[model samples]
Target chain A: MEALVRPKLQEAYEAVKRALECVHFCILIANCEVKYWGRASSKLGRGQRVIMLKQDGSVLVHRPYGYEPVNWQPPGSRLSAELKDGKLVVRAVRLRPWEELVVEVYEVHLLAHCKLRDDARFEMYGSEGDIRDLLANNPELIEKGLKRVEVERKVEGGSIDILFIDERGRLVVVEVKRGTAGAEAVIQLKKYVERLKGELGRDVRGILVAEDLARGVRGLLVREGLEFKKIDLRKLFEVSKEQGASLTHWLTRC
Target chain B: MEALVRPKLQEAYEAVKRALECVHFCILIANCEVKYWGRASSKLGRGQRVIMLKQDGSVLVHRPYGYEPVNWQPPGSRLSAELKDGKLVVRAVRLRPWEELVVEVYEVHLLAHCKLRDDARFEMYGSEGDIRDLLANNPELIEKGLKRVEVERKVEGGSIDILFIDERGRLVVVEVKRGTAGAEAVIQLKKYVERLKGELGRDVRGILVAEDLARGVRGLLVREGLEFKKIDLRKLFEVSKEQGASLTHWLTRC
Candidate 1:
């Protein structure tokens, strides 16, 4: 790892170029103007931002505020940096889509680079898939007399999250969302119901199952003749924990 | 600025704690396990991740592969670092939403911190507002005989981007998107057209203007009886540049 504090423009440029060549993750705190041309063209005027060039060829330019990067290039980009006209210019380009991001640095406050090793897989709970699995196992969580027919039933265009039969024997098509269910979720559920109604020639009901509904989505769901069910993720997580604990206890006893 | 390479766990923890107290942006490259509980709960196993703690109290954990932070806390979070049980633990908490993110570091490869000064505003072109402005000024870009009625017409729920009168003398409601128009965009345009139809008691045509269309959005637009117009952003940018050049020339002569 190499760290240079308040480095000269030329010195920072040399270090950045060397880091890129060595396939190291580099961080540069600089005042820079950024220009990006790819799917869309945008130019950000000069500002102090943190520029991160990852070993896997991902580039992120983050402003002082906000979680999202002001400018970014995904993984598998080609990166190069040089000193041009007394300033440092770093460019990242992708071949297939031909996207390019250019950062012209006027001053460098700090520059650091190091090789990172990360191989552990990410384990996430309370995702959309987890919610779907819980609902599949416990259909009563959705409704009292609902019975799960199939989970992830494939249709023509996409797959239905869960297909259930209500007490009235009507087919219910479910769409699961981990976050807020928006107008798009309602449209998706409506589409699934329409497709199932045509294929099965039966009365199909669409239900959008999510943690919460976005503003104005309830009216949209009502207009589409679909239903919205709020799932408490905390409760779901507790139930899942209990199930896991019981399973572990049974295994130990066996 | 301070940089420590392959320092002792205790030494790194003390430096991180001091940086937090001094209101500095701190970076720690370490093998860590992260747990976040907030809008949702997620756990990332022990891996080498880049942890950025900004002076504004924002925290980001990057896993080296993607542009997005695997775990993040927005600005205004309360941050603290400590050493416990032969490991370093960093915590960030938000009060309003009652969210917390904890990163337990097993090994620190690199640790750096610096006070960053940034107060520059971000200026960008070819955003949604930019597209709307261009379409409002030059309705011919959308269609030959289209005339703009209003740029942002306020409705009950939200504001329409652009409202135009087509050659057929029908009301056209335009929803401008900087990126690809997805199913949600189509649904939004449909809602706008419906609202305008009710208010005007006239035939309203819904047109979704975007740089591209997401998969299956074209079919959704068709089913919703809406129109899709692909705007070439590069051409729009060229026209904008020419306008700017002419405007600058006019100013200089004046």
Candidate 2:
């Protein structure tokens, strides 16, 4: 039985291995044979194997270490209030009441916005071909929309450097500059959000993508009912290059 | 000099604060004193002042802690082409590749060879007002020669959802799933990339929009060449609401 399933899983594992720039760890096919399967990445090494799987209504399982949820996310504060940073803070962004503006001077800037890998290092691929090959092997992941658009898109009073919506429908309106988010972007995205909601409608969320987001600005957005996502363009481009490699593979193979 | 510039910056900041949820983050004003910015959620106690200004741009400004980078990034492998878990392991997904793929998948999807982003969360907002509103805020995105053709987008097998292309100078094909980015999306986007590249140019980019993203699938896309992003439908509605609040503020003053 071990021999039969091991071959198929091994084939899948190899397919994954052949297409990546980095490999953290790999779990054993046996471990994944049971239901609810997963393993610690640190333990993956030569000759070691572990995974979780299930068969026929069974909750069979295997985990080198027990699996339990660690970082708990409270339901994001009621979606009605303004988010200061990534957290829920202000009761709301006051759709009907403009408050008196009396505050000190500060600068916030929005930089590049792109989907980052869960494995930070996974985005460090050095070549585009490598990234493209990885995509060709995946049984899932419909791979048609894989291009990155970077343009100086200008509007009535401003210009957005990179305006994109990611694979998961998140509208990431990135405003990049020489400085960090604290310098000019945070405010810029904030303003963009205000104008967008006004012209777009009252149900759109925006991300203030930047290099280093100031804590205060993060708080302001979370409390103000906005979502904040961060990324460094250098790292993102590196990751994109790998994706390019994967695309190249598909272009050649198919 | 400080006082004079402070008010303008403050007004800009206030304008920004009110504009963020509306998607106004841009670069036109980045050269101003404020260069970049984002939103921070703050738990304020009315009179409890938060340190919102940066002294030297290097200091970690507080108020809203900068939006935290997503937690849980998988680690990296140390060996070269090592075998583990009954399978052969080689490089990491985020590093430079030894050999890469070169296929452009965007063209294929647009040509009906790949899938799109219409899953569970893609349809969550279900209102034209919401979808149109979301796209409207991104005014800077070019849509001249691009086509806004509606088609039956293939999400997960058997789940064909509504899809559209906001054709400007560059075609921005959007796949709206009901929920998030899963392993299946890798295949969906790959097809799109190939089709778009084939039909348009290698430069065509695809956007797979959903509400959530599974970690493995996201890593797979990074390893591949396709792009996918996550969006919270509830939060988007909130952004629109915040804009309403800003108008209310102006109205109250009048």
Clash number by candidate, in order: 0, 218
Individual DockQ of the candidates? 0.19, 0.02
Predicted candidate 1 versus true structure: per-residue lDDT over A22-109, tens digit per residue: 9998988888989987644778877777899998898998876555577877788899988888789999998765778999999987
User: Candidate 1 at B38: error in angstroms?
Assistant: 3.0
For candidate 2, write residues A1-254 as lDDT tens digits: 11112233334333323321132111112211111101100111111112111111101111221111111111121111122332211110111222111111011111111111121121221222222232223201212222233344565578655545444444445454332467256667767656756775644445554445775777776765655444433334323332433332111121
TM-score of 2: 0.23
**Model 2, global lDDT:** 0.30
Per-candidate Cα lDDT values, in order, are 0.80, 0.30
Docking quality (DockQ) of candidate 1: 0.19
Give the poorly placed runs of model 1, Cα more than 4 Å off: A127-172, A175-202, A205-254, B127-172, B175-202, B205-254
